[model samples]
Target: MINGDFNGDGNLDIVVANEDDGYLAILLGNGNGTFTGPFYSAPIFSYQISIYAADFNADNVLDLAIASSDTYTLVISLGSGNGNFEDPTFLSPENYYSANFAIGNFDTDTIL
Candidate 1:
């Protein structure tokens, strides 16, 4: 998990992706400073990707970026205020997949 907070709220969220399952899960940031995930399961028909966490939408709530060998996709889930996240997949750009991904606001728009 990138920016792993370990409690999953909305202020310290983390981003994690798997390639074989093509699954990208976000760990929400709890205001108290912790991240929680396991929000989704690995799909049966896909490759796992490397994921990174950041607030791509600049919503203050953390967003996720899943990196594939072909591209990097964004999944910004809405926070339930309880460390739970739901669908909000936003495709970003073509990025090469690596065993690990870097997290941060490389564009100075969010956090890692």
Candidate 2:
């Protein structure tokens, strides 16, 4: 589950992982006591554990970091700002950590 305001626009988006077909659901914020989403017409993601969103590149724009502990893999997605996102330009495949990683800036702008 991705409970984050990745856009930095102040509306939290929730992305629920459908483990059946490996798809991600992006629930948009209505900004008025309601959230309307699950805007998935097709399937996305393939076997994932947990999804985290943050500024992984220090670009001030929030991005997504998806972890697959079952596969010992950690994947990341860079935000596109138009309600969609993409993967990182540079990947750290060697860093195969668990999906449910605890992330917070410990004074170095890092999400680990």
Candidate 3:
């Protein structure tokens, strides 16, 4: 699971990578410690193991980057400002597995 203010709602929300179901589930928070969701993403054939949240596109909206082991790919799902995501952009590594990810200005270019 990963947590962030994905909708810019000032409340902590959660995104769970469900490998068993081959989907991602989003749970939006109400700020009072309550949540609402299970809003799912399209099926992915790999086992999603880690999730990171950041503004990957520099669009100011939080996006999700998921690492999957089976496909050895990093899938980026851009947020739509309403706790929803667009179709994922798939990136495959030369290696055969990806288990984790981190976001930052790794190149000192002010981008992640």
Candidate 4:
């Protein structure tokens, strides 16, 4: 699970990889120690899936990046900054069984 102000609403929110259900779910916080939603992403159909969050498109909205070992691919879910995300973009990494990945400016290009 990961937490951040995903909706730009100044409230903490959560995103979790639901391996059992094959989806990524989000829980939006209400700022009063309560949360709502299990807003789900598309089914990943993988047994082992991991997730990370960031503004991958430089749009200042937090997005999600998921790695699925069963599918041997990384999926990107660009956020709409309103607690919702766009469709995923899949990429094939050199390591087919990559269980996790790092998001950063590895090339010093100021991009993720």
User: Backbone clashes in each candidate structure, one number apiece?
Assistant: 26, 0, 0, 0
Query: Which ranges of candidate 2 are over 4 A from the true structure?
Result: 41-45, 88-97, 104-112
- Worst ten in a row by lDDT for model 2: 87-96
TM-score for each model? 0.45, 0.69, 0.91, 0.90
Q: Please give the distance, in angstroms, between residue 101's alpha carbon in candidate 4 and its true position after superposition.
A: 1.1
- Rank candidates by TM-score, best first: 3, 4, 2, 1
TM-score of 1: 0.45
Please say which candidate is ahead in lDDT: 2 or 3: 3
Question: Measured by TM-score, how close is model 4 to the native structure?
Answer: 0.90
Tens-place lDDT digits, model 3, residues 20-91 = 877888899999999997688887645888888889898999998888887788888999878999999888
lDDT by residue (1-109, candidate 1, tens digit) is 4664434432555555555456555556556655445576333124434555455555565444454444444344443334444555554554633434566557764
User: What local lDDT does model 4 show for residue 43?
Assistant: 80
For model 3, state the Cα shift of residue 48 in Å: 0.6
Query: Where does model 3 exceed 4 Å of error?
Result: none
Q: Model 4 Cα displacement at 6 (Å)?
A: 1.4
On residues 19-67, what C-alpha lDDT tens digit does candidate 2 reach at each position? 6776677887777868876665244446777777777767666677766
